[model samples]
Target: MADSVPKASLYYYPPSIWCAAVLLCLEEKGYSEEEIDKKVVDLSKGENYALSFLRLNPKATVPTLVAPLEKTLSAEVESRFKALTETKTIIEFLDKSRSAFSRTNTTSSAPAPALAPATIAFTTVSNSIIDLLHSDEAHPGAARWYNARDEATLAKICPSLQAFFAAKRDAIAASLAESEKGAIQASAKTKKFWEDKSTAASEFAQLFGDGEKPESELSPEAKAKREEYFNTAKLVWETNLRNVLTRLSKEMIGPHALGDQLSLADLHLGAWLARLVTLAGGDISDKGDVAIGKLEKHIGNGFALPKDFQWTPARRDDTSEVKPVVQSKLAAFWDAVRERPSWKKVYANGLH
Candidate 1:
């Protein structure tokens, strides 16, 4: 009976935190990647606005779920294929549509959304964090230093959010090669494709915008503005992130976003925190070095953390030592998340 259930094809971009959350949820719900296709949308080049994509989602947001129409005995439900938008809506669909209920006897049973409290918490806190992370003010700093998050655990945790876009870079290289071969007809498409893969760094400068360029390379004027904007972004995100951590830890009285069990809230918050960790420019090894012997003995998971200098904790605080405290708290939560095997699988196999 379970074999007959419909699966969704998730259309997403590697860098989207919301897409990361949806993926975690999909895995938690026992949907395998084979059952659900992971389609990467190249947003850096304006592919999200591509007319072909617009047909499925006009707004061109990431993490869109497309599923076959379910056959129901009721006239109320539509019979067309479902193209769901938004992480929240898609998650709700995944939760409720687990098994088919006979439409004839629909009134005999009550169908309720699962995890009301967790959903409410996710909507309130995690949603805010995601927005603050993606706000125009924050994207620049994140895109500027996307590579700093390279850690064994992170490489294990967020490949879906990294490799998908890495593939886009490869795609662009191939397209550029095609153009070099004098494919004039494909020139316009390649132009838009390149545009979709670029970040603010590329938009402002003629650079590939891969976050490989050092801040020293930017023009004086651009460098000053970048520093100014990043500082503001740091303050804004730090304030919100600390608030969420407090609520999850001190107020909730458990390791997760709501309580002992993981929920949608954790998925949302974890994805954002993972990004913030990368932007911090330090890895789990930095903290491990402080207690590496003790941590290795205690972890029991047998996964050796990489010892690298790619990650260096960025200073977001100018007046206080609070950043470490917050980072510590966040790491504690990240550790709990890593303990979950399903959570670990999403980041496995080169992010599949």
Candidate 2:
């Protein structure tokens, strides 16, 4: 038997999106970086076997986090970790935990929580968007709405979203500007005030993930540096999303899909495209946004949803017609992405 000491086992493929999403969730849950990284495995080339994975988890999917087996271990430790570590389970665990972590975490001392979990929330939202868009009951109006969400439509929507963020950003800037004006005469509280403000600004920086630039897009040396950075973020972000999405797409859209209800997959796709464009710092051209525009339309128009598709938004105030809890989280995550400077850059470019 293999020794399970000093580490828990995580069977994962580096390129698997679910694996990455799970990893991000773990990080959000206040797990140490060392602990989180230790469990990640890159099984991209068929290294994980069905039996081996089944021994750990019957589901046998990538991103399985298995605790180290030990003789005479207390039931509590075993039960807690075991009960809480699956992808969706872990995601929920982190959602609550990250808030707690943010309250007490002295490691960063930043205004916002470390963004390791933003990616986690991103995956969750994307999954929801994907599920909603594909369901049969998807509102007919959504199709046309999505079609309209094209670059041209975004030219309109982007302005609205941008105006919202710009005002917020400007408020922060003005407050900071006031502080700078009194920097020399600043008192202890004033100094603390400025420090707090600086931390808040950096939160936006931490939340945005920028991968390396392509060699084709840059000169050799710059490309290499950008590539390295991109590789790190991409490996952790995109690669993980790919794994999760593949499983989800096949399971949901494929022939032998999961439960009758439409799920997180559709939301994931919409959120994903939204993030991609945000990351790229541009919106799709008026017509170009068509690729993902359909999804937004479906969401906006109220999907008809299949009879069996039962996950509805949990709240009465939510505009969505799907699972409320999932929708709420997704809405928050999308709000964050849209507010980022990267989003502005992308939206500006979309005008072209």
Best by lDDT: 1
Off by over 4 Å in 2: 1-9, 26-32, 40-43, 67-85, 96-291, 294-335, 338-352
Cα lDDT for residue 178, model 2?
A: 61
Model 1, 1-352: lDDT tens digits are 1333444578897766678778777666554445566899866554665546766885567889887666632345443467899767786666555425312122213332243244565556545544554455444334333322222322232334344455445545555566568753344654564556544323333322322445666787656654554454344444433343334443332345555666555666666555545443434333323333332322223522333212234676797553333223344456567666655765553221
Q: Which candidate is the best by TM-score?
A: 1
lDDT of 1 at 281: 42
* lDDT score of residue 89 within candidate 1: 75
lDDT values, one for every candidate: 0.51, 0.37
lDDT of 2 by residue, 15-95 (tens): 444444544444333454444334444332222322233345543355665543333233344322352335555444344
